[model samples]
Target chain A: MNKLVNQINDLLLQSIPSSPLETNLEESMRYSLEAGGKRIRPVLLIETLKMLSKSDNYEKGIQTALALEMVHTYSLIHDDLPAMDNDDYRRGKLTNHKVYGEWKALLAGDALLTKAFHLISTDGSIDAQTRIKLVELLSDASGHLGMIGGQTLDMESENQNISLETLQHIHKEKTGALLTFAIMAAVTIVQPSDDVSELLEDYSQHLGLIFQIKDDLLDVYGDEDKLGKPVGSDEKNHKNTYVTLLGQDKTEQKLDYHVKQAEKCLEKLREASYDTSQLEYLTQLFYQRDH
Target chain B: MNKLVNQINDLLLQSIPSSPLETNLEESMRYSLEAGGKRIRPVLLIETLKMLSKSDNYEKGIQTALALEMVHTYSLIHDDLPAMDNDDYRRGKLTNHKVYGEWKALLAGDALLTKAFHLISTDGSIDAQTRIKLVELLSDASGHLGMIGGQTLDMESENQNISLETLQHIHKEKTGALLTFAIMAAVTIVQPSDDVSELLEDYSQHLGLIFQIKDDLLDVYGDEDKLGKPVGSDEKNHKNTYVTLLGQDKTEQKLDYHVKQAEKCLEKLREASYDTSQLEYLTQLFYQRDH
Candidate 1:
C-alpha cells in the first residue's frame, strides 16, 4: 500500500507541466498537489485495479489516478477560497489561497481541473473508448451533479436546521461521488461487465458513507495534531454534520454500520470471483484514519 | 452570421443543467451563459469549421463550440469575482457574484468549466482521437500558460510600468490562446495537414491581436449604451491595454495592421485549397463590432 501510494505521488509530481510561462500557475498547482495528503483516492483506484486483476498497464492507470488527485486537490484549493470555506490551512500547511493570493489560487484550481481532463484524454495507453468513459464518469462526479452540487448544498445547509436525509445527500455527492469515481474509474478502464459495476456501486456507496461518517467522528473526537488541522471546523462553520444530527454515540454507531455494510459488499464481490483483499484493506484504513 | 450566433445561443441555453441541488450555482451558470454577447468564440469555431469544409459534424462541432463559450463565460464569471476584477456589471447586467453572491458565483464558474470537459467528452458522434485532441488543446489554452496565464499577467501587470511586448504577450495568451484553439479545434476535426495548421496559427495569432486591440479601442472610445457596459474600465482597473500602451491613433494603426495580416494568412489558406470566406467574414465583424 505504501509503495502504491508513493508511485501515485511520483506520478502526480511528474504530471505537473514544466512550461516556460512566467506566471506561477504551475507552481500553485504543484504547491497543492504536493501538499502531502494520504493519496487515498489514487491508492484506492490502483488497488481496485489490482483487485480486479486489470493491472496490465500500471503506468496508464497511475496517470488516471494522478488526474483523480488533481481533481481532488483542485477542489480543495477552490473550497479554501475566501468566497467558500476560506480555509487558511489544509493538510498541515498553508492553503493554496494562503500561499498564493486569491487570484492565483483561483487560476491554479481552474488549471488543475482543466489538467485532469487533459491528462485523462491524452493518456494514449488507455483505450480510447475507456478514456471517453473515464471522462464521462469523472466529470459527472466532479461537476454540477456531483461534488460541486454537494458543495453548494453543504454551504447552503450551513447554519440551518437540515434533515438527516439532506446531510446524507450532501455527503454522497460532495465527497462520495469522487471516492466512488475512484472505484468506477478503474472499472471503466478494465471494461468490466455491468454486473461488476452494480456490485462495485454497492461497495462504493457504502465506502462513501463510511468515509463521511468517520469524517464527522474525527471532527468531533480525533486529535488535531494527527489530523493536521483543527477538528472543530464543522461546528465553527455551523455545518449540520452527523455529530450534530445524531450525537457522538449515534454517529459512531452509524459509522460502524456503514463499515459492516461496505465489508458485506466486498464479500459479495469476492463471491463474484474477484480478489477483494486490497479494497477490504483500504476500507480498514478509511475506517481508522485520524485525519 | 446571425444564424450561427443564434445557434450558439440556443446551445448555450440548452447545455445548462436544471438539476435539483437547490442552490443558485446552476442559476449563476445560466445567468452568465445566458448573458448576451457576440458569441464570438463559438462563431469563430463554427465558422472555422465551415471554412475548413468540416461542417458535416455540425452538431458535434457545436458541442465543442458550446464548450468554448462555457470556457469564455466561466472565465468572465471568475474574472468578475471580488478577488479578481470585482465588476458588478457584465454585458449590461449585474455580474454573477452580485446576483448569486460570491460563493455560488465561484462554484458556478467551476461547474461551467467542468461541464466543458463533460460536454466535449460525451459528444459520442465525434471520434475519440479528435475529442482527445480538443481536450488537450482546450486545456492547454484554458489552463496555465494560456488563458489563465494571460489573466495572471493581466492582473500582475496592473498598475505596473510594462512594455508593449509584455502587454502583447499577455493579450495573446489571455484572449488569443483560446481564439487560436477555436481555429485549431476545427482543423483537428477536419484532419488538416501540418502546413495548413502552420498557416492557421499565423491566422489565429493575428486574429487574436486584432480582437484584443479592438477590445481596447472599445474600452476607450466606444459608447456605453451600444457596448452594453461602461467604457473607460481599462483605465478604472489600471489595465495596460493596447490603447494604453500605444495611444489611440497608434492602437488603431496596430488593429488595422493585424487585420491585414490576418487576411494575408487567410489568403494563404485559400491558396492551400481551403475556402476562407467564413473566417474572413468573422474577422470583418470583429473589425467592425462596436460592442
Candidate 2:
C-alpha cells in the first residue's frame, strides 16, 4: 500500500505542467503536493477500490484521487498564505506564497482547485455518469458549505477563544468533510455493500477526528525534524487546539479513544467480509503521524 | 424576459449573505456579484429555456445561470486585482481587493468560484446527472485550458503585437467559452434537436466574438458615466485590443460582419422552426451596446 502510495505521488507530481505563464505556480502547487506527507486520501481511495475487487475502476479512481489530493493541496496553500495562517514554512520548506509571491500562489491554488474537477470530468476512464457523480461529490467537498465554510470559521476564530463544540464543528467541516468524502466517494464509485459503506463512513469519521486530535498533540510534543515543522508552533501562534483546551494528557486520551473507535469500526467490517486491515493500518498511521 | 432577468438578479443578491468574515471577504464578493450588469448570461439562459418551453427545467436553469454569473463575476474580480489588470475601480466602485485587502479579495474570488458548482449540485431542481454536466461545463470554462489560459495569453500580450488568429483563440477561450457553455448547456438540458443546438453554437460563438470586438471599441470610445469606467482605459494600460491590432476602421467592419453572421445563423434556426428571435435580439443588443 505504501509503495502504491509513492507511485501515485509520483504520478501526481508529474501531472502539473511547467510553462512560462505557469510562473512558479506549478512549483507552488507541487511543493506542498509533493511534500512528504502520507498520501492517505488517494491511497485509501485506491485501496478501497482494490478491496472491493473493482480494480477496473482504478484508472478513474487514480484521477479522482489526484483531484482530491489537489483540492487538499490547494487548501493548504491558501491556508498557509500570509493573510491566512501567516506560516513561513510547511513540511520543512518555505510556504508556497512565501516563495512564489502571493499573486502566483493565489492563481496556483485557484488553478489546482479547478483542475481537480477538470481532470475528473475529462478523464475518459470513468463512465460519464460516474464522472458526473465524482464532480458532484468533489464540488460539495470544496464549496462554501464544506471545507471553505470551515475555513471561514477557522479564520473567524483567530485570536478569540472558541468553545470546544465550536472547535469540533469547525474541524468537522474543515478536516472531517474531505476525509469523509475520500472514503465515501471511493466506496460509492467502487460499489460496496451497504454494510461495508456504512462501516467506511464510521471508520473515516472516527479516524478523521483522531487525526485532528493527534495533529493538535503533535504540534506541542513532536520533534521539529520528524514533524517537518517547529514544535509548539501552534502555541506560538496562540491558536486554539485540542491541547490548548483539553490539556496534553486529556488530548492524548481523546486521540486514543477515537483511534480505538476507528479500529473497532474496522473490526466490524472485517467480519462482514471486507479486507480492512489496510484501513486499520491507515488509522493507526494517522494517529501516530507528527505533521 | 426582462422581468425574469431582474428577478434573477434580485434573487442572486438575496441568496448571497452579506456578513463580516476575517475581513471584508463577503463584501468584496457581494460587491462584484451585486454590481449592476445586464445579467446577460442569465437572460440568455432563461430565454433559451423559454424557447424550449422547458419551464420545469427553469428552476435548475436559473441556479445554473446564477452560478455562471458567479463564475463570470469572479473572473472580473481576479482580473481587476493588482497583479492582473490593476484596476482600482469597476462598475463605479472599488475593485474587490481594493475595498477589501488582497487576501480577502483573493479568497472572495475563490469562494465565489467554488460556490458556483456547489449551487448546481445542491439544487434539488436539477437531477444529479444534469448537475454533473453543468459542473463539467463550468469547470472546463474556468480551468487553465479555458479562461485561465486566455488570461495568461492576455497578460503575455500586454504592450506586444498580437495576431488576429491569436486574438481569436484568446477571446474564444476567455470570453466565448462561457458564452458557448451558456447556450450549449441549455440546449443539452432541453434536449433540443441537433440542428438547432449546432445553430445556437454558431450563433453564440459569432455573437461572443462580436461582443469582444465591441468591448474593445467601447474601451476606446465609450462614455465613462455610461460604461461605468473610464474610456481608453485599455489603451492607457498599453493593452492590446482588436482596435489596436486591426485598426479601428477594420475592427468596426469585423464587428459588423460577425454580428450579421450571428443574425444570419439565427435566421436559419428560425427557418428550422426554432423560433429563436430572442437570441437574435440578444446578438443585436450586444453589437449595439455603447458600453
Candidate 3:
C-alpha cells in the first residue's frame, strides 16, 4: 500500500502542469493531492489488479490508478468549496479554497479533472480502445450520471428528511460508482473471466457501502486530531447519512453487514483460485480504520 | 449558419441531463447553452469538417462539435458565477447563478465539461485512435495549458495592468486555443494533409485574435439588447484586453489585420483543393457582426 501510495503521489505530482503561466493552478492541485490522506482508491485498484492477474501488468494500470486518484482529489476539492460543504480544512491542511481563494481553487479542481482525462487520453502504454473504455467508464462515474449526480442529490437531500433508499442511491453514485470504476477498470484492463468480473463487481458494491458507513461512523466518533477535520458537519448541515437514517446502532449493524458481505465475496474469489490476500487485507483495513 | 445553429441548439438540449436528481444542473446548463448566442465554436468545427471530408462523417463529429459547445458553455457558466464574473445576465437571459444559485451553477458547469469528454470518448462514429487524439488536443486546449490556464491568467492579470504580450498570451490559450482545437479537431478527424493542417493552425490562430478582438469591441460598443448582456464587462472587471492595450482604434486595426490574414489562409486552403467557402463567409460575418 505504501509503495502504491508513493507511486501514485509521484505520478500525480508529475502529471500536473509545471507551466509558468499556471503555476498557481498546479500548486493548488498539488496542495490537496499531497496532503497525505490515505490513497484508498488507487490502493484498491492496485490490489484488485494484483488479485486478478499473474503478470506484473499491474504496473501498466498504474497510470489509470493515478487517473482515479486525480478524479478523487478533484472531487474533494470541489466538494469542499465554499459553495458546497464550505469546508475550511481537509486532512489537517487548509482547504484548497482557504489557501488559493475560491476562483483559483475552482480552476485547480477543473484542471485536475481535465488533467485526469488528459493523462488517460495521452497514455501511449494503454491501447487506444482500452483507453477509450477507461474514459467511458471514468466519465460515467465522474459526470452527471455518477459522482456529480450523487453530489447534486446529496446537496438536495440536505436539511430534508430523505428515505434510506435515496441515501443508498446517493452513496452508490457519489462514492460507490468511482470505487466500482476503479475495480472495474482493472477488470477491463486485465480481461478477467466473466465469473471473476461479476464477483468483483459485487465485491466493490459492498465495499463502497462499507467505506461510506465507516465515513459516517468516523464523523460521529473518530478522534478530531487524527481525523484532521471537525466532525458533526453532517448534523450541522442537516445532511442525510447512514448514521442519520439508520441511527448509530443500526448504522453500525449496516456497516458490519456490508463488510461481511464484502469479505464473503473475497472468500468466493479465493475459492475460484484467485489471489485474494491483498484485497482481504484492504477489506480488513476498511473495517478497522480509526482515523 | 442558421442551420448549424439550430442543429447545435437541439443537440445541446439533448446532451444535458434530465435526471430528476439534477434537473437544476441540467437547467443551469441549458440556460447558458440555449441563450441564443452565435454558435461560433461548433460552427467552426462543423464547417472545417465540411471543408475536409466527403463521407458525411462530419455528422459523427457533430457530437464532438456539441462537446466543444458544452466546453464553451461551461466556461461561460463558470465565468459568470458570483465567485468569478458576478454577472446577472447572459445572452439576454439571467446568468445561471442568477437562476440556479452558485452551487448548482458550478456543478452544471462541471457536468457540462465532463459530458463534453463523455461525448468524445463514447463517440462511435470516429475510430478510437482519432477519438483519443481529439481528446488529447481538446483536453490540451481546455486544461491548464489551454483555456483554464488562460482563465487563470485572465484572473491574475486583472488589476495588474499587464502588457500586450501577456494579454495575448492569455487569450491565445484561454480564447484562441479551443477555437484552434475546434478547427484542429476537425483536421484530426479528417486526417488532413500536414500542409493543410499547418495552414489551418495558422488560420485559427488569426481567427482566434479576430474573435477576441471582436469580443473586446462588442464589450465596448455592442448593443445591450443584441449582445444579450450589457457591455463594458472587460472595463468593469479591469481586465486587460486588446482594446485596453492598443486603444479602440488600434484594436480595430488589429482585428482587420488578423481577419485579412485568416482570409489569406482560407484562400490558400482553397488553392490547395479544399473548398473554404463556408469558412470564408464565417470570417466575413465575424468582421461584420454588430453584436
Candidate 4:
C-alpha cells in the first residue's frame, strides 16, 4: 500500500506540467494536489483493477486513478473556499484559497476538474469506448445529480435538525458517489462478470458508508494532530453528521455493521475464486483509520 | 440564426432533468443556463458543422452545441462569483451567486462544467472515436492551458499597464480558446480534410480576436441597455482592455484587421468549394455586435 501511494504521488506531480503561459494557475493546482492525502480513492481503483484481473499490471488503470485523485483534490479546494466551508487548514497546510487568494484558488480548482477529463480522454493506452464510458460514469458520479447535489443538501442542512435518512443521503451522494466511481471505474476497465461486478459495487457502497461514518467519528474523538484539523468542527458548524444523528455509540455500531457487510461482500467475491486480499485490507484501513 | 437560437434554448431547458435528490442544485444550474445570452458559441459550432458538412441535418451537432453552451455558461457563473468579478448582474438579471447564494452557484457552475463532458461522452450519434476526440479537444481548449489560464492572467493584470502582446495573449486564452473550440468541434465531427481544418482553425482564431476586441469596444461606447449592464465598468475595474491599451481608433482598426483576416479564411474555404456564407455572416455579427 505504501508503495502504491508513492507511485500515485509521483504520477500526480507529473500530471500538470508548468505552463509557459504567464499565470500561477498551474502552481495553485499543483499546490493542493501535492498537499498529501491518503490517496485512498486512487488506491482503491488500482487495487480493485489488480484484484479483479488477477494481475499486478495495473498500468492501464493509472490514468483513471490519477483522474479520480484530481477530482477529489479539486472538490477539497472548492469546499475550503470562504464562500463554501471557509476552511483555512486542510491536512495541516494552508488551504488553496488561503495561499493563492480566493479567485486564483477558485480558478485552480476549475482547471484541475477540467484537467481530470482531459487526462482520461488523452490516455492513449485506453481504447476510445472505455475512455468514453469512464467520462460518462465520472460526470454522472461527480456532477449535479451526485457529489454536487449532496454538497447542496449538506450546506442547506447545516444548523437544522436533520433526520438520519437525510444524513445518509447526503453522505451517499457527497462522498459515496466518488468512492463508488473509484471501484466501478476499475470494474469498467476489467469487464468483470456481472455477478462479480454487482458484488464489488455492493462492497464499495458499504465501504463508502464506513468511510464517512468513520470521518464523523474521527471529528468527535480522533486526535487533531493526526487528523490535521481541529476536532468537533461538525458540532461547531452545527452540521448534522452521522455522529450527530446517531450518538457516538450508535455511530460505532453503524460503522461496525458496514464493516461486516463489506466483509460479507468480499466473502462472496472470494467464493467466486477471485483474490480479495487487497480489497480486504482496504476495508480494514477504512474501518480503523485514525484520520 | 433565430431558429437555431430557439432550438438551443429548448434543449438547454431539457438538458438537466430534476433530480430525485433533496436539493435545489438542478434548479440553480438551470437558472443561469436559462438566463438568455446570444448563444453565440453553440451557434458557431452548429453553423460551422453545417457549412463544412453541407448537411442541414445538424441533429448530430445539437448535443455538442448544447455542451459548448454549458461550458460558456459555467464560466460566466464562476467568473461572476463574489471572489472573482463580484458582479451583481449579468444579462440584465442577477448573477448566479446573487440568485442562488455563493456556494450553490459555485456548485452549479461545477456541475455544469462536468455535465459538458458527460453530454459529449454520451452522444451516441457520434462514433466512440469522435466523441473521445471532442472530449480531448474541449478539455484542452477550456482547461488550464486555455480558458482558465487566460482568466488567471486577466485577473493578475488588473490595474496594471500591460503590453499589447500580453493583453492579446490574455484574451486569446480567456475568451478565444473556447471560441476556437466552438468551430473546431464541428470540424472534428465532420472529419474535414487537413487543409480545410487548418483554414477553419485560422478563421476561428481571427473570429475569437474579433469577439474580444468588439467586447472591449462595446464596454466603452455601446449602449448600456443593449449590453444589459453599465458601460465603462471595465475602466472602473481598471482592466487593461484593447480600448485602454490601443485607444478607440487603433482598437477599432485591430478589430477590422481580424474581421478581414477571418473573411480571408472563409474566402479560401469558398475557393475550396465549401459554403462560406454562414461563416461570413458570423464574422460580421462578431464584428458589429453592440453587446
Candidate 5:
C-alpha cells in the first residue's frame, strides 16, 4: 500500500540466502515466501512502529518481517506435507516436499523455521535486548501454546464438524497469534502508550478474525487462479470452516462487521501519528480481496 | 560429576512437559533428552560461568543448559526422521516417529527446538540482550554454517568414504559447534576474561572431538544394553567413522590425545576465579566413558 512497504519487501527477498548446499531448501522457501500473498503481517509491524515513533530501527522491523515470513512459509511447507494436509500443490506449483523430495523439504522447513530467530536475534542494527524481545514474541507465537497448538487442533478437526468455539480457538491461535505478535512487536519496540498498544491489539484481533473468515469464504467461492491453489480444498478434505459452520451470507456479514470494528479502533489513534489511510487501504484490501 | 550437576539434571528432567495432546511428543523428546548421557555440555557451561564469576547467575546458566539440551534434542529428533537417518530406535526407546507417528513427531521436534529460545529469552532473570546473544550463539552453532550444515554434508557423504579433512569439518560443525556454544554462552553472559574464554573454547573443541571418537569406538565395541541402541548400526549402514577410517587403535589414540589437549587447556585455567576442576573431570570422562 506504500512505497516503504514495497521497499521492505524487495530488500527482504534480496537478503535471504541462495545457498548451493541446500538449493531446494532455498527454492522452496523462496517460492512460498515470495508467493504473492499480501505481506500484511510485516506491513502491519513496520507501519505500527512508524506510527508510534520515527526511528531508524526499521531494520529490526524488517528482520521481524522476514522472520515472520519464514515462520509463515515453514508452516505452509509443512502443512502441505503428505502426513499433514497431503496437498500436492500450493500457489499453483508443486509443494516443497513434492518438488524437493520429502526429506529435503522437511529439512528445509526445519532450516527456515530455525533460521527465523537467528535472523531476528543476529541483526546487528537492533539493540540486543530488543532483539531478544522480538525472539520472545515470535517464539511464543509459534510454540505449543500458539501456532503449533492451533495446528494440532486443526489436524484433529479434519473431516469432523466442530463447534463454533472450538473453531474460533483453533483459528485464533493458528492465524491470529502471529498477527497479534506482528502488531505487538512494533508496539513493544516503540514503547508506545498503553492505550495505543491496547487499541492496536483490539484492531489486530478484529482484523485477524476477518482474515480467517475471508479465507473460509474464498475457499467456497474464490477463483482458483487468483487464490493460487485449488478451490474447495477444505471441503474435499472434509475440513470445517467458518463458512461451513455459518453459511456464506453470515460469513460475509461477519467479515463486514469485523472490518468496521477494526476501523473504529484505528479511529482512537492520533490522526497526526499515522497515515490512517494506509491502514484503511490495508483493511479494505484484506477483506475485499478475492484471493 | 558434582552434586550440583546431578541436581541440575534433575531439574531439567522435571521441567519438561508431558501433556496428553503431545504425550508421545513429550516421550519422544524425553527418549533422547532423558536418556542418561553424560550431560557434559550443560555442565561445562555452568562450570565455565561459575569459573568466570561465582555471581548469582547460576540460574541463568541452568536455563542456558536447558536451552542447549533442547537444541541438542531437537537435532536428534529430526536426524532420526524417516527422511533423515530413519532409525527405528534411539537410546532404548522407539525413535520419535516410531512412537508418535511421523507428522506429530516432526512437529514435536519443531516445538521443542523453538521452545528452547523462548525458555532462555523469557527466563526473566537474565537481561534480554544477553538472552539474544545466547540465541545467536545457539543459531550459529546449529544453523547453516553450523550443525545443520554439518548434517547436510554427513548425509551427502553417507556410504561414501570421506577424506579426513572433510570428516573433521563435519565433526567441527556437527559436534563441536554446540560444545563451543556451551562454553561461549557462559562467557557471553558472565563477560569472562578473554583469556578464560579462549581457553574454554580450546578445551571444548578438543572435548568435542574426543566425544565423537569415543562414539565411534562405542559403535565397534559397545554393548547394546549399555549403549542403549544397537552397536554396529553405523557399520550396517556402511557409514565411515573414525574407527573405520583410522582403525580402532588409532581412533582410541586420537581420543586420548584430544582428552590430554583438553586437560592442558583446563590446566591453564586451574587458578581462575571459578572452579575448573569440574571441567577437567568432564574432559577426562569423555575419553573414559564406555558409551
Candidate 6:
C-alpha cells in the first residue's frame, strides 16, 4: 500500500510540467496537487485493477488513476475558496487559495480539472472506446448530477434540520460517487465477467458508505494533530453529517454495518478465485482511518 | 448565421436539465448559458464544418460546437467572479454571481466545463477516435497551456506595462485558443486533406486575432448600448489591451491586417473548390462589428 501511494505521488508530481508561459497558473496547480493527501482514490483504482487482473502490468491504469486524483484535488481547491468552505488550511498546510490568491487558485482548479480529461484522452495505453467510457463516467460522477449536486445540497442544508435520508443522499453523491468511480474505472479497464462486475460494484458501494461514515466519525472523534485540522468543524459550521444525523454511537454502528457488507463482497470475490487481499485491506483502512 | 445561432441557443437551453435534487446549481448553470450572447463560437464551428464538407448535414458537429460554447461560457462565469473581473452584468443581464451568489456561480462554471467534455464524449455521431481527439483538442485549447494561461497572464498584466508581443500572446491564448478550437474541431470532424487543414488553421489564427483586436477597439470606441456594458471598463480596470498598447488607429490597422489575412486564407480555400462565402462574411462581421 505504501509502495502504491509513493508511486501515485511521484506520477502526480511529474504530471504538470512548468509552463514556459508568463503565468504562475501552473505553479498554483502544482501547489495544490503537491499538497499531499492520502492518495486514497488513486490507490484504490490501481489496487482494484491489480487484484482483478492478477498482474503487475497495472501501467494502463496509472493515467486514469492520476486523472481521478486530479479531479479530487480540483474539488478540494474550489471547496477551500472563500466563496465555498473558505478554509485557510488543509492537510496541515496552507490551502491553495492561501498560497495563491483566490483567482489564481480558482483558475488553477479549473486547469487541473481540464487537465484530468486531457490525461485520460491522451493515455495511449487505452483503446478509444474505453477512453470514451472513462470520460463519460468521470463527467457524470464529478459534474452537477453527482459531486457538485451533492455540494449544492450540502450548502443549502447548512443551519437547517435535515432528514437522515437527505444527509445520506448528500454524502452518497458528494463523496461516494468519486470513490465508486475509482473502483468502477478499474473494473472498466479489466472487463471482468458480469457476475464479478456486479460483486465488485456492490463492494464499491459499501466501501463508499464506509469511507464517508468514517469521515463523519473522525471529524468528531479523531485527533487534530493526526487529522491535520480541528475536529467538530462540521458542527461549528452547522453542517450535517452522519454523526449529526445518527449521533456518534449510531454512526459507528452504521459504519460497522457497511464495513461488514464490504468485507462480504470481498469474500464473494475471493470465492470466485480473485485475490481480494488488497481491497480487503483498503476496506479496513476506510473503516478505521483517523483522517 | 442567424439560423446556426438559434440552433446553438436551443441546444444550450436543453443541454442542462433541472436537477431532481434539492439544489439550484442547475438553474444557475442554465441561467448563464441562456444569457444570450452572439453564439459566435458555435456558429464558427458549424459554419466551418459546413464549408469544409460542402454538405448541410452538419448535425455531427453540433455537440462539439455546443461543447466549445460551454467552455467559452464557463470562462465568462469565472471571469465575472468577485476575485476576478467582478462584473455586474453580461449580455445586458445580471452576471451569474450576482444572480446566484458567488459559490453557486463558481460551481456552475465548474459543472459547465465538465459537461463540455461529457458532451463530446457522448457524441454518438462521431467515432470513438474522433471523440478522443475532440477531448484532447478541447482540453489543450482550454486548459492551463491555453485559455486559462492567457487569463492568468492577462490578470497579472493588470496595472503593469506589457509589450505588444506579450499582449498578443495573452489574447492568443486567453480568447483566441477557443476560437481556434471552433475552426479546428470542424476540420477534425471533416478529416480534410493536410493542405486544406493547414489553410483552415491559418484562417482560424487570423480570425482569433481579428476577434480580440476588434474587442479591444470596441472597448474604446463602441456604443455602450450595443455592447450592453460600459465601454471604458478595460481602461478603468487598468488592463493592458491592443488599444492600450497600440492606440486606436494602430489597433484598427492591426484588425484590418488580420481581416485581410483571414480573407486570403478563405480565398485559398475557395480556389481549392470549397465554399468560403460564410467564412468571408464572418471575417467582415468581426472586422466591422461594434460589439
**The best candidate in terms of lDDT:** 4
- Candidate 3, residue B271: the lDDT equals 89
Taking candidate 5, what TM-score does its chain B reach relative to the real chain B? 0.90
lDDT string, candidate 6, A103-178, tens digits? 9999999999999999999999989999999999999999999999999899999999999989888988899899
Q: What is candidate 2's CA lDDT for residue A198?
A: 85
Question: Candidate 3, residues A188-246: lDDT per residue as tens digits?
Answer: 88888999999999999999998899999998888887787778877887889888888
The CAPRI classification for model 5 reads as medium
Per-model interface RMSD values are 1.2, 3.3, 1.1, 0.6, 2.2, 0.6
* Order of quality (DockQ): 4, 6, 3, 1, 5, 2
DockQ of every candidate? 0.77, 0.41, 0.77, 0.90, 0.56, 0.89
- Interface RMSD (one decimal) of model 5: 2.2
lDDT (0 to 1) per candidate: 0.87, 0.78, 0.87, 0.92, 0.79, 0.91
DockQ of 4: 0.90
How much does candidate 3 score in TM-score? 0.97
Please say which candidate is ahead in TM-score: 3 or 4: 4
Least well predicted 10-residue stretch by lDDT in candidate 2 chain B: B18-27
B40-122, model 4: which lDDT tens digit per residue?
Answer: 99999999999988989897789999998999899999999989989898887899889889999999999999999999999
* Count of clashing residue pairs in every prediction: 0, 0, 1, 0, 2, 0
Candidate 5 regions off by >4 Å? A2-10, A18-36, A54-57, A270-273, B2-6, B13-36, B54-57, B271-274
> Of the pair 1 and 6, which is ahead by DockQ?
6
lDDT of 1 by residue, A115-187 (tens): 8988988887888777877888898999999999999999999899999999999999999999999998888
Candidate 4's C-alpha runs over 4 A off are none
Across A1-291, the per-residue lDDT of candidate 4 in tens digits comes to 899999999899898998978677888899999996899999999999999989999988999999999999999999999999899988789999999999999999999999999999999878999999999999999988889889888999999998988888999999999999999999999998999999989999999999999999999999988887889989999999888888999999999999999999999999999899999999999999998
Candidate 2's docking class is acceptable
| Cα-based RMSD of candidate 3 | 1.6
Local accuracy of candidate 5 as per-residue lDDT tens digits, B1-291:
467668766776676676434424455556556654567778778877877776545877888888888888888888888878888876666777887788777787888888888888887878877888888788778876678777777777788988887888879888989999998988888886788878888887898898888988999899887877778988898887997789888887888888889888877887664567767767767777877
- C-alpha RMSD over true interface residues, model 6: 0.6
User: What is the overall TM-score of model 6 with all chains considered together?
Assistant: 0.99
How far in Å is the alpha carbon of B126 misplaced in model 4? 0.4
